[model samples]
Structure formats: C-alpha cells, structure tokens
Target: MSFSLTTDARETFIFAAKNVFRDYETTPPAPEPITGNTWDNVTGNEVKEAALALIRDGKDPAKDKSIQELLLRWQLSQSGIFPVLAAENENQTLINEFNAAVKGLEALTPAAEEDAQILANAASRLTIPNLGDSYSGSPRDAMLHAGARVADARLSKYAEAAGTLLYLRGIQVQGEHMTPNWFALAPLTFKDAHRHSLRSAGTASPWTLAHARINIEPAANIEEIQERINAYTTGKRAIERQVEAALPQWQNLPRDAYQDAITRAVNGETMRDARGGIVTWAN
Candidate 1:
C-alpha cells in the first residue's frame, strides 16, 4: 500500500504503543468484540469496502460533484489500488490511506476540481481507530459523557480527527478571543444553543438546539464539515452503534462527537483528581 503519515501520526503511535504495552491508561478504551462478533470475522478488505460504500452513498451527487468523484475513488479502493495499510499501526495506516485516498481521488476527478478540493478538505479530518485496551479497564471510557465543557472540547478534537471543521461556539468576550488559528485549520464558533443540542422527547435523546449559530473563525472553514457530515453518515452511524452497544450504560449520552473532540482538543491541557474532576494543568 502507499506509504505516508497523516498529521497525527506521532500522537497516534505513542497512544497505540501505550495501549498495547500498558493497556491504555490515558485514553478511552476500545470496545470489545462480542463472542462471534462480525467484526472479528471481517477482514481488513471487508472493512475497507464498508468504508468505501459508506463514502460512496454518503454524499449527494447533485449537490457535491467533488464528493461524487470521491465516491468513484472509493470504488477504486475496493480494487486494492491503494497501498497496503499496516492495520496494526492504526495511525500510520490511517495517515497513509487518507493521503493516498485524497491523491488518487484528485487525480481521478481533475475535471471536478472544486469537488476534489472539497473531498481532500474533508478527508483531512478523518482518523484511524486508536490503540485501545479492553483487558484491564472498564469496557468504555468512564469519562466519555462527562459534561458540557468537556464535551465541547472533545467534540473539537473529534472534529479535528474526523476531518470535520468545527467552531467553538462560545461567547466572544472580545472581538478577538485567543482561539486556535482558523487559517491553518477550518475552525468556527457558533452560539451556545446551536452548538449544544438539548434532548427532547420523540426525537433523538441528545438532540441539539438549532437556534445556536456558528461564527466563522477568521481562519477555519465549515464547508468541509458540512460535506463530511454528508459523506460518512453510514460509517459514523456504524461507529455510533458499536460504541452504544459496547457502552449501553451510557446510552442517550450527549454528543459523543463533542466529548471525543473536547478530549483531544486539550489533550495534555489538564489532569484529573480522585473524583475524576478537573485539576490544574501540571505545567
């Protein structure tokens, strides 16, 4: 398979190693496959194919020509044109595959330049599964659905990893808040209500409010976030299902994307004390 590294290779590698050696002391635990789980029987090819099909049907061809072209590229992935991904090295493989997928997608659909750009843009946030430990720890991350602020930070990280452009959606104390550079990344902010959905009956339990609106961080963009939301719905759904099944105790939990994003956003920003509450950053 094509060889390359995604932006988060260094962090992923260290994380994966720790999972294998120390059983993931610092991060969320991977879900365990149930006895006779389909995931275990499924080969890497099957998983790749699943990803391809999800990408293929995820976007609307009429609205997103670039995504249409990307759909074709995903079809090609099914043929094994892509490089051999080192499955054991989730970070390396994800990085390599993401890079290769974008390059191949671009080459195949040069005519749809905008579409290609969009695909590449969204693909940037996609990340491989992290190293996880199921043996010693609880079946899930105890800190998964901790709180709103935590969820927001983790949501940002999830967006970063999944290639979804995100905004902090917080009140701007001043015209200029010290936020991440949107120029280098596609960051934005929205009204709290819009960014944070509240649960309502007869609808998704963790439904977010629509009133909150996003503020364009000077440097970040959300066009790709929209595209990502469209393109990988199935895969995302599958992940959601798997996570929910694994951690039924936390069902109806708020936006997992938010939680994951926040966790990664301030990866080393804080420490937790005995009650699992935040402590001052060691630094």
Candidate 2:
C-alpha cells in the first residue's frame, strides 16, 4: 500500500519544508515595531502568576526548591506548565531560560555512539536507483523518502550517543520510550479520512502542479511543517550528543529526575512516559 500523510501528519511535514528553506523567504518582512511589547509583556505577570501558583500549590516542592524541582510535576498539561506561554511574548528572557532548561535535559548522553556509527556505515552502503528526481510523481516520492531515511539515519546516530533524536533544530531528547513525534505549522483540527490523503489517494490529489511549480496552498503548508520537523530533529540530536559528552560532569543532577525532565520537555507529557520513571521540569 502507498504511504500517505494525514492533514495533521502532513502539517508537520510542511513545517519541516519551511525550516529547510527558512533562509529563503518569498514574503517581505514587515517593518520592525517602533513601539511594541516584548516577550515579558506578552507573557505578562498574570500568566507567570498562574504558572508559579501551579508550581507552588499543585507541585510537591514549592518555589523554595530548585527551579528544576519546581517544574517537575508541572511540565505536562500546562494545567501546571502552561503551554500558553508564547515565545514571542513580552518575556523572552524567561522564555529563553525555560527553553534552555528543557534543551539541557535532552542533551544528556548514553553509551551507544559506536553502535550508531556502525549502523550508519551499513546504511551508507545501501543505495537504490533514483529515477524519480526527473519526474513529479512516484519517482519524486521515492527520492523524498530516500533522502529522509538518510537524514533519519544521521539523527539516529546522534540519538544513540545522547538519548533523544533531535527532531527540531534546537530541540533534543533521549530515545527510551520517546515517541517519534512531529508538530504542524498551524494548529490542526483532527478529522477523519474523508480529508484527501486519508481517503481516496488514487482518485484525489491534495495538491496540484502548475507551471512546473506545485500550485497548491497545501503544498506550502506541508513544506513548512516538514522544515520544522527537520530543524527540531537536528537540534535535538546535537543536544543528545552533548548530553552524552557531558554526562559525568552533571552528576549532581538526579538521574531519574533528569530523565523525567527529558520526557516532559520532548513529549510534553508525563514523566511516567519517560522511561517508566517520574521526573520534573523546573518552572
């Protein structure tokens, strides 16, 4: 059977494309705001108050503890962690700190670097004919898949040493029980197979080609999604390697606790999903 991506799934795919071509934009940048709020103002005291409250009341260790301890249980659901915190909010300072904290955990190391290299070397020896680059359909699809596998292999190697596959350019995490997750460029509405790719693959086209350039709005969307996934994955893998290289240095940081941080940061879920142990994210 032919593989197809759903609207939700393809959203991530499109995001990856955008990241791939992030340096090349078709749109002109709007003039910078002469007077606009920053990440602090955007996030505001109100949200921080709420985030802190969750840490103090909902979490076991209150604000009196380390930032890592404070964030431990609250990382998931935003009920405590507050995913509503925007990067562009008026508080880029705090946002950057939080982002770094999350990235820091996924940046832990493991002992499988040599094994990964062996796998990558084996993959490099395998090749399939690429007749698709000359065409716009099956051949194109084949080429895309081949390129993705090569990239995935490289990422896998990084994860082998560090722990998590870096799906986003700046994001990283370990692999134990981690999902091969991807995010979309736009907020997605989950619908059934009636939506194009999920349904009639042979009869329907989610997008079209015109003037030798894909002439579908959905194409742009998919491209951006793909770009994000690739960027994040790359960064995530890099962090993973760093985690391995510096594992012994950060020994003061708890093992189970740190791993929990990785799960909360990467999957945005509970620590239970992170290697069957509970961990925390410092608020």
Candidate 2 positional error at 53, Å? 92
What lDDT score is found at residue 187 in candidate 2? 15
Give the range where candidate 1 is weakest over 10 consecutive residues by summed lDDT. 198-207
Residues 48-121 of candidate 1: C-alpha lDDT, one tens digit per residue: 56556656888434455554555566576656544433344444444444444333322322222222233233
Clashes of each: 34, 62
- The lDDT of each candidate is 0.32, 0.32
TM-scores for all candidates?
Answer: 0.18, 0.18
Q: Write the per-residue lDDT of candidate 2 for residues 1-283, one digit (tens) a residue.
A: 0232233433343343233223222222222342343222223344456567767677733444554433443344335334344433424433333333223322211112222333234334333323123334466455554553444333333222121112433232223222222222111111111111221222111111111121112112223544544554565555444434434433455787554444344443433322344433231
Stretches of candidate 2 off by over 4 Å are 1-182, 186-219, 248-255, 260-283
